[model samples]
Target: MSVTAAPGFVAAGVAAGIKASGNPDLSLVATADGKPVAAAGVFTRNKMTAAPVITTRAHLEATAGHAVAVVLNSGNANAATGQQGIDDAEAMCAAVATELGVDASQVLVCSTGLIGIPMPIDVIKAGIPSVVAARSADGGQAAATAIMTTDTVAKQVVIDGGGFVVGGMAKGAAMLSPNMATMLAVLTTDAAATPEQLKAALVYGVADSFNALDVDGCTSTNDTVLLLASGLAGSVDEAALNDAVARACASLAAQMCADAEGATKVVRMTVTGAASDEEALLGARYVSRSNLVKCSWYGCDPYWGRIASDLGSCGIDFDPSKFSVSYGGITVCRGAIDADHDAAAVASHMAGRNLEIVADLGLGTGTATILTNDLSHAYIDENMGTS
Candidate 1:
């Protein structure tokens, strides 16, 4: 169990024939009692938004961040289809709401898969009852499995917050970047909380977790992270709730990076000594999303020049002559030039499945870290075809 592990939540996934392979494509999550819970969502900043995203945002607003259920489908993104797409998303929500005896505004929707494709509304509607009937505590794994697009494995996390537990599941592999990507996540907690408190915790959690990962630098139209809390497990302080949610999101982020499409190495880029933490993040993001840098990582090359160039291009004030770069704790570049060290040791370290690169700007006390993966020929192969 993932989401259901938090208690007060029931989840299920079913094969609604939305996928050509007849795999599980529909997933539903709701309170165990079919009542609304405190809800907060973070969506993609992409301007070319998907229909499901629009509907879900509106529902959250209409209900003032209270929701009874969430319905999601894979294999068709229901994006870029204009008004028809919006209607289809609403219809999906309506069907789920009808079955649960809840208002449409209390049911949120999300879709992922190939973009620009219309949703199979009738097939999904017909399967709503079955999914609703199948809801149980044991269905969290199935729900996690159903949301995957190109992910090879389900991502789930459960964290103990002293008095309460926070559980979550997420799906994403490619198209991962800062500000989110082609990902959908649901977080549940039994700890008592208001919608405003949930929003604050989610914002704090997402900032350093999901929003810190950069895979292929492509943000999706359907990226969503929704947190729901049922006041069943007694009360928890805001700080504890925020920490627990952040821990869960961070775990999920690491899992996504490990399962990234065609990735061979998971890399952590730490930027330090920036003029500001924001500038440090800018520098880290530039290096993480640089194709040159990613390709060098794939080849097990400690190409310090690429990192230097990326940091310089971040538009942040950094003294190139004073900055330094290190790979796997070994200084590779010092004072913006190559440093003589044991080349064999550095090469051996880069060959591992996990690695870290550090860039010290020698500016001020500001730091940030970015999690990413190496670019490979297989990544191109996977994206060259249909998404």
Candidate 2:
């Protein structure tokens, strides 16, 4: 839940006067080793993305998907601002490069908060120097807090006992569904990895993690998950690199589920015995995002039918007679039919902060796990406050 300072990287967060509320809105995370050896990004599916997303995409492409620093801001999405917005986002990157003595293409930019607002470029420009100067190892937490909108707490994860070190932070609360979510996450590791290897590892990690969660079934135009490897830990060892990236990503993904907005419970929907991993993920994600299923969990209702029905409708080829379900270690349904398990005990188990729903397809060995949050009135109230 916390990231200690690692060698070669320094981060800083500053009140850039971008937000009307006067909170820190700009942050910088950079490495002293110059450019990162490898990087991978998963972006929002929303077609109407912000200027920063557009500009960053271009930079990543131009650099063949590598970066040395990331500059982020909150309170103004910098979306829908057209040409000027693009100009401003690039300017932010250029400014950071000037301060850090790196190429502009080596800096990635991200923004979040109210949509349709133009960035406060003047304030951001003024704050750049200070943020650059303030960068240090422990600045990851501050950078995480700086990019939050309605989030009640900063999301961070770290694992250091292994031979390599991996750490990361994420921000999300509302508008969180996948094809990406209304979220921004950054992960760093000292492990050495080639760009291709890093990209592969990230794709594998997110397949069963960030891509699994949904808060309100709404995707943000700015959702992005970026991973950077400084290679400061030394030459690449394929196995070690994979382990570090997987551990870091898994930890951060769990944090995102646990901190889902107004969520009293975090659920893991595991789908097994499918014909393929893709089919299992398809079915599991369907159950995770079903409003009725989420509400059942929130209300402490043992509605196994809702869960089973949602999974069945996901367009995966499966026999109804082969299905089975369990809630919190209690088998509530078997062979495509309801079980005689005690509903009251299952409901009580669902009331806790963590819940697990296992679905067996009885088809094949392929499987996948989806993470999600329980739906609640408070989630509605929190997001609607700004609307």
Candidate 3:
């Protein structure tokens, strides 16, 4: 509902035959009027990246951050395939650009799913025509649904501004701990903005959401977060636009957390009293990445030891004696463990669909919050020998 929620953007998804499950594996998004729009993107930091990520990066640079369309495919990552992979990615871009009567450099490409396999370029190319033809003003929902891998539900968000709207769609559930950004997210706005404005808004806005998300502490080869400004509704306040973008990103990120692989509850982690904001984030990330801590969370156990131990590994100057931890605002540990709290009350708090884990470093007045999911057997079962 969100990506297409903005004006002047149409989208569609089609079964490209790249997926063995017979699901729609390819999608296309472009301006309704077939014109270039200001765009900016943040991609994966992994050294071994998919072909689409490489192509999109180069195109954004070559075109001066102006693009008319983005073509994406699922089921094959097109990574580690050397020059052929690059060629295939280029062909996908060319196919769309040619059909839309725009320069090849004005098109971006994205791919997700299995890694280290050759992409079915022929099938993807054949599906491009059908995908482009199916573009509709109300097609964002279909596009979101088509990008799913292991996710149980599609994630989308829309925020209305005074004279415009900001909307987005994202697909991600696992392999999430992003370095620069996460997953395949495309955000659009109807407000008039420069390419530089779009870039600054996105680079800063993601820090509040995707940058803080950690599903399994893994980064994929195909992470991409692209923002496009259509300028259909005319000029908008710069501050308002930025805030709208951030809100839309945060909403989608929360959805992704709830839909994480084998996850039951979403853990909202806040690390306070660190030496600095950077240190607080580092501490929270370490705790989020700890499988031991995630397992404890699944058991509804207020195991402060795991949080204390993992935060210490961030290499920050931490004092164990001054550390304290809490779950659902119930202090389970302070200097020494606090055993006077009602056990039933604490467990009941932990059993909720949304739980909070707060840590106090007791060092300084720094704070950071992140979203993660509890570890469960379904996560293991879903990932075993699959990709």
Measured against the true structure, the TM-scores of the candidates, in listed sequence, are: 0.98, 0.92, 0.97
Worst 10 residues of 1 by lDDT: 174-183
lDDT of 2 by residue, 147-264 (tens): 8777778887776725667778778877777574568888777777766777787777676566777666688888888777776677656766666666766777677777777898
Q: Which of the two, 1 or 2, has more TM-score?
A: 1
> What alpha-carbon RMSD in Å does predicted model 2 have with respect to the real structure?
2.3
Candidate 1: segments with Cα more than 4 A from true spot: 178-180
Model 2 / residue 33 / CA error / Å: 5.5
Which residue runs of candidate 2 sit more than 4 Å off their true CA positions?
A: 1-4, 33-38, 385-387
What is the Å distance of residue 255 in model 1 from its true position? 0.9
Q: Write the per-residue lDDT of candidate 1 for residues 1-387, one digit (tens) a residue.
A: 888999899999999989988889999889999999999999999999999999999999999999999999989999899999999999999999999999999999999999987778999999899999999999999999888888999999899998899998889998888494578999999999999999999999999999999998889989999999988988898999999999999999999999999999999999999999999999998899899999999999999999998888779987988899989999989999899988998999899999988999998998999999999999999999888
Regions of model 3 farther than 4 Å from truth: none
Model 1, TM vs. native: 0.98
User: Which rank order by TM-score, best down to worst?
Assistant: 1, 3, 2
How many residue pairs clash (N, CA or C atoms closer than 3 angstroms) in each of the candidate models, in the order given? 0, 1, 0
> Candidate 3, residue 197: CA error in Å?
0.4
Listed per candidate, the RMSD to the true structure in angstroms reads: 1.0, 2.3, 1.2
